[model samples]
Target: MSGTGDTAPGADAGELPAYAERVLSVAELIPAGRVMTYGDVAEYLAEEGQPEGLPAEGGGGRRVGGPRQVGRVMALYGGAVPWWRVVRADGRLLPGSELRALAHYRDEGTPLRAASQGSDDHIPKIDMRRARWDGRQDERDAPWDD
Candidate 1:
């Protein structure tokens, strides 16, 4: 599959590889309050047809199981992805241009599982271990469970 041609909220359909598309889909599914890590996105993207077993770092030579790739993707072309749903591994909001992601979170009313003021310029990241969502509960499922 080359391109789905369906640009989602945080992704550019035609520009992304099929795997990135899949990751974007999963990210879109994340509820407003919950969040996912880059590693999660990479794994999900792999599941969606991204090549697996390849190293994720250093041009895919290093093992990448965390959220770096996903975060990088979102940082550049996350306009259509549910970017707010994909936070840094530390639970800190992903950096963005013009508070775009933050606006979505505030507008969507996503729960702030972590503390952040945005004034620090260097936001306090969230702890993914504690903030990463499994999408198990009803509320978690609502954002994309349909």
Candidate 2:
């Protein structure tokens, strides 16, 4: 693939990694009570978007094209993945027919830094800048672990 989304050299389009699979890897990695942003995962996939230690190079750099793209995958097929980890850009939840998503978040101990401060009209957001996980690089890199 010469361009960003182009088929990698000698690689068939069908051989490319599925975006949902990438989404789920991190989803599964997130501890039961933690969460992440769609853009955060997008950043991880895009390299530039991830923070210091995300495995951005994974998925052969072929994760979903963007955050919105990731969101669409989750919307359609996130039933088994950690759907709650992905929140809106502003830290709000992505909507769906299952009213239980929010309730599930509440039950899993997904951090709610906003404390429902916004409004009655919106799902309470987590303030991405504050609550975003730093990924496990720091934990794995701790001097004691080695």
Candidate 3:
């Protein structure tokens, strides 16, 4: 986990740290045209030391390590994975890499909101309501809660 940034996880006879590996694994599971927030990724992995009072099942658990740590792992060791599939909570593209990420999103047919005329930079955004993936069964497919 300490080297030139060009090397990908397991690229040079080395492996990513355990937590980072888990994070990248979850990133890989995000299907094409869908996305997960950093927090969602953390919850999906069920990392240890989750905060209290959140349920362990059904994606109600508090995420472990929070978003910044997840971002760090992605920055450090995520080049080989579909790094763009992990995104901000608000569904905005990653700063400094927006165009590159948007290219992937377009190619995958991820839903997007066309930029409004009044938008600060007129940059399109992810249509999160239609595109968010929580690593769970579709609500339509789940049995009724009752």
Candidate 4:
């Protein structure tokens, strides 16, 4: 991966953990100008299919695709995808790469909220209300949609 200068385990051999591949694919599916938080990505994957590294329900095993795990996947293998589209739940720009992310957000017409005048960095935040993508284009008949 081209991000953070540290390849994930097995990355040097052009391989990624199956979970990492799933996360990256979700990142790719996010439309330009829209975003998913790490939690959202994890939840989406969970609702859609059986995630890698996760045991089936009632198996009493640990799960591996929570928000933090999703974030780790992005940090390691995100550069090949639209990394900026995966954002924090609070809508704050990614630290250390705020400017770069801002450029991508602007280019994609993603909604943004201006920083308050008293802010130190004065960086705009993503407008989560407007920019968050839930991966649902229509109301599914699932009970959870209630």
TM-score per model over all chains: 0.54, 0.61, 0.74, 0.78
lDDT of 3 by residue, 1-146 (tens): 12113456455567656677667777877788888898887766665443343235435343456677888888878887888888887878887777888889999999899887887977789888788886653434321122
- lDDT tens per residue, model 4, 15-70: 67767777887787788888999998888777735435433443422355799888
| Stronger candidate by TM-score (2 vs 3) | 3
lDDT value, candidate 3, whole model: 0.72
Instruction: Spell out the clash pairs found in candidate 4.
Output: none
lDDT per residue as tens, model 1, 1-146: 11111243434335665445545666766666567767766665444233444224334323343466565556556656566677655555654432555566557655544445555674444444444666443553333221
lDDT accuracy of residue 98 in candidate 1: 24
lDDT of 2 by residue, 35-146 (tens): 5677776766665444433344443564446877777666655555566666676765554422455676678766565436557655566545545664555533321121
Q: Rank order by lDDT, top first?
A: 4, 3, 2, 1
Per-residue lDDT, model 1, residue 137, is: 37
User: By TM-score, who's the top model here?
Assistant: 4
Pick out the ten consecutive residues of candidate 4 with the lowest summed lDDT.
137-146
* lDDT values for all models: 0.52, 0.55, 0.72, 0.76
TM-score of 1: 0.54
> Is candidate 1 or 2 superior in TM-score?
2
Q: In order, what is each prediction's RMSD in angstroms?
A: 8.5, 9.4, 6.9, 5.4
TM-score: the better of candidates 1 and 4: 4
